[model samples]
Target: MAFKHKSTLLILTAGVFSCTPAWAASVSVVGLFKDKAIVSIDGGRPRTLSVGQTVQGVKLVAADSGSASFDVDGKRRTLGMGQSFAGGAQPGARQSVSLTADARGHFAAAGSLNGYPMTFLVDTGATSIAISAAEAKRIGLDYKAGEVTGVGTAAGVVPAWRVKFNTVKVGGITVSQVDGMVVETGLSVPLLGMSFLNRMEMRRDGQTMTLTQRY
Candidate 1:
């Protein structure tokens, strides 16, 4: 049977993960079965966790018996079996990074928001970078000081906050003064949207995506 929950699960907040220096830790999906998954955090001992359970703040959101969704550092990210998020290139090392698609053809990356660790789900459909209120609060983003707005999802219209991120970094590419949206509720993951993507040269070939800094 599929694991289901009421919409209220959207607002559930938990403890944040341990902090390491930049490019120190990583997360990966090892095996996934309906409602259950095996994952590795920071390359430590691998373990099995049920949906909604968290391992060092990496909460398992959903499992399709093939791919699994995880809430890493307050951002929702999906990954198929065997896909991993790695510590990025060294500081001032390079200005480009490549991402490989998981078995489910989804692209994800390890990054940061305002120097806070985060996981980014590639969403070309999103107009700007999108974060959940839970995430905005965790990362100390002053979204309420920005404009109030609403976002239309399949469920309905939900309240959102329009704010600017001081800096968003993925691998070695960092974009400053990025526009972002904070959904008041009903958003589980933070989307790596166009506000950041538009600043880079994005190219996809088969299962690999290459992102290079533009300026």
Candidate 2:
């Protein structure tokens, strides 16, 4: 009886992590069909995206189960699910959210708060998510690199400090009042970090990474 009980436990454990194979979270779009959300194309050329919707270039293409096939700019593409879009919401919530990066390591989004549309880079290396001093000026944040503050990085101890951005957007998402430090001086690109990321739907698609915020 003990042996049987042990076998049952193992089965249960496996079952717990193993979700429906149809929607296993995958972050690639080659030859499979995924539930792709088209956001933008031509890098926001032509007309800008309207509010209350995703951009026009977000494509989820793949032929695997739950693979996605859709059109963008009159072009056909295939996509696949990076992860199950279900069961990824707040308790008793009805809305779902997801983000799939393209071959160029870009997750496209088109959204505006108070009538301002913004783009962002989804960077995981940032310790606390940051923006450049210049961007800080744009977002209305007082982003002045203060005394050389010390921070850790893959290279080694580097000079860094905090600079606020007016706003940063990723996965058709946005966050405000975000405080993050710099890695090296004179670098002027916005880095998305986990500081504001902790509230979103976070998951890994192997070499592919995804962040979706469902409100």
Candidate 3:
């Protein structure tokens, strides 16, 4: 079973890790259909569930092609197929967001930067959150005036701006004053890296990665 305190064996290449297990108590959206779904709890096993069915502390309130609505610990949560919900809670409780890998086994999360909608590719190896210069401008960020730096990319080294974000959010979790980098070249997708991940308790089981707030 995956948990926060245990360190799973991870292979590192060029100081970067891939498909490694990271963060939480686990819950998964195994299958999603027009109005039905299958979910699992704690990675123990998979079970087929339907609307209004409660299994392993998760109550499937509703299900559709794009999402599954669940009630956990008296709070309602909705997760897309393949995503997990281990850290589902209200504002006062432990907050978290769980993501499942796509066919390529890469974890991508739907969230926002400074309240503007954006997609984030979860990259644990990165030292800080990284965004493209275009994205920073789209989100009205003044990263151009931030600290100048150099960042290595697949193409080559490029000029980058180190900036602190006012807010970064995923699902119900929000983190503020997040240190990040705005690469002037060669980045299309923003990376959700250590600057944000380090603040959460993380765990993984198979293709699912869960992040829970440390506090």
What RMSD does each model have against the real structure? 13.4, 16.1, 10.2
Candidate 1 residue pairs in backbone clash: 76-189
Q: Predictions ranked by TM-score, top down?
A: 3, 1, 2
Clashes of each: 1, 34, 5
Q: Which rank order by lDDT, best down to worst?
A: 1, 3, 2
lDDT of 2 by residue, 71-181 (tens): 333344444433212112235543223445555444433232222333334455445664434544554544444444655434444456655444444423445655565
- Which has the better TM-score: candidate 1, or candidate 3? 3
**Residues 68-186 of candidate 1: C-alpha lDDT, one tens digit per residue:** 98876556678888887654445564466677776656666666788676776777877888888999999888889988877776566777888989988775566799988888876
| Per-model TM against the reference | 0.59, 0.42, 0.60
How does candidate 1 fare on TM-score?
0.59
Candidate 3 clashing pairs, residues 3+ apart or interchain: 22-202, 22-203, 22-204, 23-202, 23-203
lDDT of each candidate versus the true structure: 0.70, 0.38, 0.69
Q: Write the per-residue lDDT of candidate 3 for residues 109-188, one digit (tens) a residue.
A: 66668866566777887778888898888878898898887877766677888899998876556789988888887776
For TM-score, the strongest prediction is 3
